[model samples]
Target: MLKRCGRRYIVGAIRTYAKDIRFGPEARGLLLKGVDIMANAVSATLGPRGRNVLIEQLMISPRITKDGITVANNVQLEDRRCNMGAQLLRQTTSNTNNEVGDGTTTATILAKGMASQGLEVIRQGQVNVHALREGMLEASRVVCEELQSMSQIVETIGEVEAVATIALNGDKRLSDMIGDAILKLGEGGVFLLKESKCLNDELKVQEGVTLPEGFVSPLFANQGNGNRVEYSNVLLLATLANIERLDEILPALELAKSKEQPLLIIANDISADVVKALVMNQLRNCLRVCAVKAPSHGSEQRDQMQDLALAMGANLLENATGLSAIEAEDLGVVSEVIVDSSSTHLLHPRIHNEDQVHARVQHIRALMEEAITDEEVDKLNERMGRLFGYLATIYVGGANELEVSEKKDRLNDALHAVHGAISDGIVPGGGTAYLRCIPALESLAPSETPEHQIGRDIVRNSLRLPCYTIARNAGVNPDEVIRQVLEGSGNFGYDAAAGQFCDLKERGIVDPTGALRSAMSEAAGIASLLATTEVLITEERIRPKVPRNQVTKDLAGLIGM
Candidate 1:
């Protein structure tokens, strides 16, 4: 019995801890292979003349895109080790995306180049891997500082369009619309992109607030062809009360139904069964109603709802009793309401209580003046924006669904780039900003060790990869372009589209300094990790069981039966 138990224990241990392990050069080489494969695919779409990748999708038509993150997300490898490496690279791209919302392509190439070069150095021996990683990390910080100092503020609408145009892949119309929207909305503005039936894109700017909380249920979006629940001349009921049963708000619903007016309910909470009943009633045309949970919580929720109530000239219901006692005259009127799953927009036709609105604005400004922390200041600014902000929606038009998807992807990237620029500023573009940092990076620091120097060298050398890839994609000799850019000083870089050396900033070609900084820093950190890694462990792939009949047929075929 002891022997049997021992055997069972051994089997269970094996099943529990089964993993495929790799070590040393073999592991690093396989990882580099993965980095190469993914980087190569994404690098093709690096410049103005860059090529689009056609991606095969399941349950939908294939998508053709020039977006780097989209390409990286679709990569899957047959080899587990390679897939692990690919996934690591994907992390780099994702980090860059989350940090800056653009420059995923640049980040991918930088990570691949840094990892590959670092591996080659490791193969050459003599350097401490830990020291090398430390050096790279330090070098990344220095480069970011240099880029920050080199960045110029985007102070003009033309400059904004220039940055947008590059990110949008030379779409002037889209860039123009985005620039106009940015200019009109100013700082802390909110805008949305929507698909348009027309072949030409359209833009609409309005004065309103876009709340983070959207419709409580999608069924409330029945009025529109898309997911948006839109209403004209709607009545709004704002309350801090939680609706536990349908009877809680049945009177208000009946009032709206009798008045033949659309009603929007902003409450603290509504039970699932209550939401279901509301949805069903709307679907059956029993009532024209939509429900959304009020934005924020506690005191914040009260303040926002009060601000909204003030704007709508409605009574602020503080408890369940007020909600139950709601009347037709108690509901506030709004010119329009647009809601999606993620956000809600309320537009007032005109300020109902103009003096009260002004007083509220002044009170918020006073609070801002007395604010002690950055968070407080930000919250006040957001409240101010909500009260008097411009909400713009860009209706993206395309020839078909595929074109629309691709265009929307590009537009989102551009929008993010614009935001990055606004927050941090803009720097030289087309890899020029990275290439210019090599000299400073290569300069030896006073306390740098030999291994640190080698590591720093690896990063500085790898920095040239973006420019080289862009030139190669543009069908130019990358070496000559690099040499020329190095010889020229101060914002001089190769224009892959124009195939000549010119002033990048003068040509209106630039990248968000924040995006480039994020790309370089994230790439350096990940590549250093990959370089120091000596062990790779992954789940052992299990083979599916074959049926006895299929196995027998295979054996008979082997015997020529």
Candidate 2:
């Protein structure tokens, strides 16, 4: 019998590997070494005092950053197997950063320590993987309860700023901007990112809405008189038809031209001939119209187009095999259309039917009240925002391209962090949140058997490494700082920025509970996976290579030598 991933094997893929495989100690050792290598690379940038890593680009200027994701992403190891192993662990950090924001460094460090420590118990081969897994999970359950018990409510704008500040590694300017933006946007309001208008270290947020779709040609840009064209009563025509043929789109164009209305066509594609005609007609000042490809492709994208159409009282057409009738009642209305090179903006369009909009809103709210998990709530939030309040944009600026790029990444982290804090309660940042769970973790020690004890102890103590790194990176001794904090009140921890120990929450250094929990779960899960992995069969590592003599002959033949 042979093991198969699903029902079949991929073509040109390794099937049964008797060779090119590492097992037991050798495989486990490689995994641990990979974790260690990556951990050491990122440990330097763990706290507010954490320094940036400078990486030189081949054809451009160098990049310097303290962002853990940036460092992890830039790494490429010589050993492919080791690199793959490190990447698997890095996925834990990636998800944490993507989902809740922040804690990439903490997540990586926790994973390294757990996998390193858990390997010892796993090597004994006395405790089953299931048992170790159970012990870890139970410890997590306890830690989570402790986190809830210690969480601080985030109800004000200041608290939101605090969370964003900590996540951005203490960027006060960025933090203040994020806090103000979130407060101004209020509930269900969107926060979008845009490039800076000027090369100055300034952060600005404007009230605006954008769709992923944009206009096809700049020629139709409503730059009437070199001023922003306030194009109104624009029809949003969504269809799957290729309106390239003159007759198909001619009716719609003629109808809009007659009514003195602008037509904003959204379709899979329009004929080049049609686009030329539209541009020429607009140039002659006889018509105002632009044809842009519908955002997204395929069925899902078409459905989104239909949804937008329905919301705007526009007619949606499908399977239009020939020229179709264009009706005035099928047209949609927008308050204004602002076109830029990047995207087209449609501002505050009315639904026209207030009673119906209110009823639909109440129904969606009911469904949302029953929704759980981030994905469900996110869907509803987006739906509500699209129907009612529109999304806003924040333009992050800096003195240079590099600075703006880095600031954008930092602002993204801050944005998500602020959102997470608003949705969930806050916990003390700077590692104090994890350390606070130790007493609870240890409380389970008395009931633990020897096998469970080893796993449980690792989980308990590994939590301190994050704080240790935070303190050490701050130019202080972690051991002394930890000792002092543990001796003092539960809330107190080492603040490397201030170069002293203090209460983390009181000083406005806090994290969202959701981010912390997501990171912890991801770290523990990956560590368990690494510890339990006993064999490594790298198909890529065993691929046959072409001989140099053959390659040389091929090159010589090409040159007619």
In lDDT terms, which candidate is top?
Answer: 1
Alpha carbon deviation, residue 488, candidate 2 (Å): 3.7
Each model's lDDT comes to 0.85, 0.73
Question: Which 10-residue window of candidate 1 scores lowest in summed lDDT?
Answer: 539-548
Would you give me the overall lDDT of model 1? 0.85
Runs of candidate 1 exceeding 4 Å displacement: 1-17, 209-237, 240-318, 322-389, 446-448, 546-561
lDDT per residue for candidate 2 within 329-432, as digits (tens), equals: 66667767676555666665554455655665677668766675545655555555555546555676767767876777677677777777878789888888
Tell me the TM-score of each prediction against the true structure: 0.72, 0.74
Q: Candidate 1: give the clashing pairs.
A: none
